[model samples]
Target: MFIREITHWFARRSFQNRIFLLILFTSTIVMLAITWYLTDITKERLHYQVGQRALIQAMQISAMPELVEAVEAHDLPRIKALIDPMRSFSDATYITVGNEKGQRLYHVNPNEIGKYMEGGDSDDALYNAKSYVSVRKGSLGSSLRGKSPIQDSTGKVIGIVSVGYTLEQLESWLNLQISSLLFPMALLLLVLLYCARRFSLHIKKQMLNMEPQQLSQLLIQQSVLFESVFEGLIAIDSQHRITAINQTARRLLNLSQPESELIGYAIHHIVLPEAFFYDAPQKNKKDEIVTFNQMKVIASRMAVIIDNQPQGWVISFRNKDDINTLSLQLSQVRQYADNLRAVQHEHRNLISTIAGLLFLKRYDNALALIQQQSESHQKVLDFISHNFRDHHLAGLLIGKYYRAKELGLELIFDPSSFVEHLPSSLSHNEWISIVGNLLDNAYNTTLLNREGSRQIECLINSEGNEVIIEVADQGCGIDENIRQHIFERGVTTHNNGDHGIGLWLVHSYVKQANGDIIVDNNNPFGTIFTLYIPFTREE
Candidate 1:
């Protein structure tokens, strides 16, 4: 349970903190293990080295003629004399000479001379004529001892020569070895820990100091939001190849099929302008209309920057259908507001005129004037409402009527103008675009004409799956040269820097609906634009 708790606590730490702790723990364990291993090896190697030296000394002393002669003569003093020089050179703690019967003949400690040796290794050297090394307790305490045979001329062992190092002496040498090994090992471990800490800090900075779990959760949320967005989103690499695309993007780009996957595909092949993917300057483009698969979309693009350099581009877009729908709704609201303002202004003037007439005791005049004005207004409203059966179309005409009057311009409907129960192929929004722009254009043109000629005429009729519309204005007619590009965008007679997008929009809508438009400017009075839009919707 304690171990499990430690693991859980460590997992909760930030990435850099965990890394630092991990490196410190592992290095400590490894260094400690190495220290232990080296210490053990040093002890064993030093013991072996001391044993070999002692064995060599013992062998040399055993083969000495002085020692052999002394042992044959039983001269203990001479045996001690011969062995003393070799034993002092070998650094052994104690040296002894023993007879075949285990009687100590010569000893470093004189009290032990002529006494029986207690160790078994010295007996093995004498009786078996063998060299032996072992650790045993002796007069000098626990010691590493080596024994060699003292043989006679007949090759039979006569005695034994023994050399031993006391445990205290071995320990002094082992301690020195351990100090030497530990100093360098400790230095290396310190250096390793310092480097590990530096590396951990670097990693922490790169990871924004966030924990792995936090980063993982953020990634999951980003993925969910990206996929769930309604706007089409696409990410492209510097090479202009598609890197990422959301589901909405796939549908908008017509990549719904399995084989139509856009990942790794070049953006050029996808039909967007190359300028949109250019790498220079890394500026963003917003709300740019681009056509793909006969569908219009408003696209926005921004460069993805990393470390102050451009990595890729991200493009997002919305379908033009939705954009147009919103635009139509706003247009309808604005039109109603304009009409309301105009009605309010006109009613205020009429009320003031009636009040003045009634205050002067001209009751009959005020009543007759009110009846005339009401009948005139009701007649026009009834005619438009009865002829144009669609409520939206009727509303648009009513709004336009008041709007024209507000500008002090007479708006006249052709006597033959009539439309009833149009099919669904002609959307209400499309009708607004067609009727609104045409009437607006005519009104603006008439504003340029003389006061007497400030009049706009509108005509509308339906004929078997088709609708015909005509708007004529008694304004200055168009120039023959201007007629050629009059329907193009940015071509305008207005010098106020306003573009001529109205006609272009009308032309585009007519062509998109598979309709036709004819401009008649041959008349000296004004220009007349006639349009025929089919009621059959394009598939």
Candidate 2:
């Protein structure tokens, strides 16, 4: 339990602190171990070297004939004179001359000259007449000692000569060796710690100083959010490779492979319309509307920047169904508002007329005029409500009636125009555009004529999933030169600063509905436009 606690405590430390501690601990252990090992080895080697010199010194003293004769005569003073000078000159810690009976004859300490010698190497040198070297403890502490036997001319042993050096001398030399190594080892430890600190700092910067567990949690959250979004999103790297693609993006792109394998592949290989991603990232990002997989979608792009440098890009898109639905709602609201404004203007004019008649004291005439106007407006409303059961179509025709009357022009629905049912395939907006633009164009052209003839006629009929519409205006007929391309974009007879997209939009809608449109410019009075739109509803 205690060991585990220590490990846990160390793991919780900051990266730099942990690294420093580890490096220092390891380096200290290694250098100390090496120093201890080398110190012991040097001590043993020095002891052996000093022992060799001691043996040589003992041999030189034993070779003197004067020392052998003096030992044979039991002359202590002569022996001491012979050995004392050798001890001082050879730097030996102790020198002793002893007889073969194990009794000391001469010593550095003169009081022990007659003492009995005690030690295994001393016995081997004196009695057995052999020379040897060994380590032993004496009165002056531990020492490396070398011993040799002195003999007469017949090779008989007389006495022994022993030379010794204390272990304290070896210890002093070992201290000097350690002193030389300490500085270099300290420098090496400092270098190791510095390198470890630098390495830890680099890793911290790369990871933004966040814990590993925190980074893992953040990645999991981002992944969940990416897949949960309804809109499609994709990320591209600087090399134009697809780095990431969400589920919605894969589905929109019509990809069959797994997202993992799709990464690192060039985006151009996946998206068929390669022009969509040709432009690099710019400061001002814009939303682009494009067609993908036969579906209309709005795409938006943004650059991923770091330190004011471009790294990659992220693109997101949403399908156009939502935008179109909102646009339809807004157009309906605007149409209703226009209808109300026209009605308001007409009512104001009527109120003024009635006020003028009353102010002139013509009460009977004002009442009659109000009744007549009421009856006329009711008749027009009743006719529209009765003929068209579809509220949208009826509302549009009624609104146009007021608009036409306001312009001093007469607008009428043909008696033969009958639609018992409206199909679902033709949307309300499409119907409004087709009928509304045609009527508007007719009204504008008829109003241009000052020949005292300003009139328009509208016919609407449906038969077996097909809708037929015909609008005619008593204005100057279309010119033959521009009639061929009249339904094309940027083609208009008005010659005003307009985009001339009304007829083009009409033609485009008819084509999208698989319908047809024809122009009858051969009319003696004005021009006529007829449209046929077909739709199918499954049973």
Candidate 3:
């Protein structure tokens, strides 16, 4: 339970604090262990050195000829006189001279003279003439003593010499050594703690000061957002190596390799055109058309910046075909709105005319006008509905008829025109773009000639192996110089910027369906557009 509490406490701290505490704890443990080991070693060495010094001093006193002769003659005064000066000059706490009978003849204390050695440890030195060091309690109480035997001319042991250092004195010396060592050890520990703190702070800064859990959650959210975008996205490092690529990018690029295999590959190794990589790093480029894997795309390049520093680039793109489809759909909606407005205006005019005839009491004329208007609208609706099976195509023609009437031009469908169904070779929208753009072009062109027939003719036939559409308008003919490039983007007879895309889209869709288009000069004046598309049965 205590350990669990400690773990919880540690876990509650901030990341930087936790790192600091862990480092400090580990370093402190290591330093303490080293200090303890050194202290033990120092203590043992100090004791060994002290004992050796005492032994050497005892040996020197025992070897003195005058001390040995005095002990042999059993002369207490001579022994005391010979040892006093030596004892006063030495570091040993006490020195004593003892006869062969284990009775002290000379001592640092006068009372200790003539007394038997209190430690009873002089047997070996007095009888066997051995010199050694020992820890024993004597008149001076617990001391480390070195004893040496005195020998006469015959080599017989005559007396003993003892040199002693008290435990108190040894302890004082050890304390002095330890105090010197401790100061540096404490300084080293403080330095280690300071370094650990700096290291922890550095680590925290690198992590952006966020916890690990927060970073993990952020990563998960970013991954979801990165993959959820509709546009294809790719990120590359400064070295032009792929760092990240979304699934949409892989699909758009027609790459079958897994994302894991694509990462770290050089960006140039992918199927992007050279233009995407050139002048890409120095500045951002947007909405530039470039071919990727042989497919044209509207792409944008942006530099990835962090902390006001350039890291790499992020490129986003979408297929141009997708953009064209969206544009076509929006155009169709606008056309529908325009047709509704025209129908409303035409009805309002008819209503006002009928009301005026009623006010004048001309009932027969009002009835005739109503019948004529109904028949005209019903005839065109019936023709479109009965001939074109696809509702979208029928509706498009009906809307175009109303739009043409509003523009003061006649929109006539060829009597021989019949369309059962569009083939599966092209989407309905593509077919719509082709047929709608042609009729719209005819409408615009015929309106240019105020003195002409002001009529546009359309023919759609799908009864054979191919689908054929022809639109002829009695308007100014196409210019000889620009007829060749009329299908190219940004080529238009009108001065408006928006006038060029319709024909280009029509040409693009036709080519994508593997179809052919022919432009011809109509008789007298105007232009004719004919499209032939091969039909394939839907599986």
In terms of lDDT, the best-performing candidate is 3
lDDT of 1 by residue, 289-383 (tens): 55655567767889888788878889898898898889888998898898899899888899999999989999999999999989989998998
- Give me the overall lDDT of model 2: 0.81
For every candidate in turn, the CA RMSD to the true structure comes to 10.9, 13.4, 11.8
Comparison by lDDT, 2 against 3, better one: 3
| Cα lDDT, all candidates | 0.82, 0.81, 0.87
Q: Across residues 1-539, which tens digit of lDDT does each residue of candidate 2 receive?
A: 99999899999987666766787778778878988897888877887888898898888888799999998999987887777777667788898888878688887777776788655557777677777788888756788888899998899998888888888876777788778888987888788778777877776776678766777898899899989999888888877799999999888878889889999998888776765666756542344555566675767778888668777888788876776698679868877887888888899999999999999999999999999999999998998898787888889899899988888788888987777766665567768878988998898788776763777989998855688999999877788998998987678878586747778768866876778998996255778999988766651
The candidate 1 region of ten consecutive residues with least summed lDDT is 272-281
Q: Over 4 Å off in model 3, which ranges? A: 118-128, 231-245, 250-539
Candidate 2: worst 10 consecutive residues by lDDT?
A: 280-289
Better of 1 and 2 by TM-score: 1
TM-score for each candidate, following the candidate numbering: 0.56, 0.48, 0.56
Clashing residue pairs, candidate 3? none
Tell me the TM-score of model 3. 0.56
Model 1 CA deviation exceeding 4 Å by range: 1-15, 234-245, 254-306, 309-315, 324-539
Ranking by lDDT: 3, 1, 2
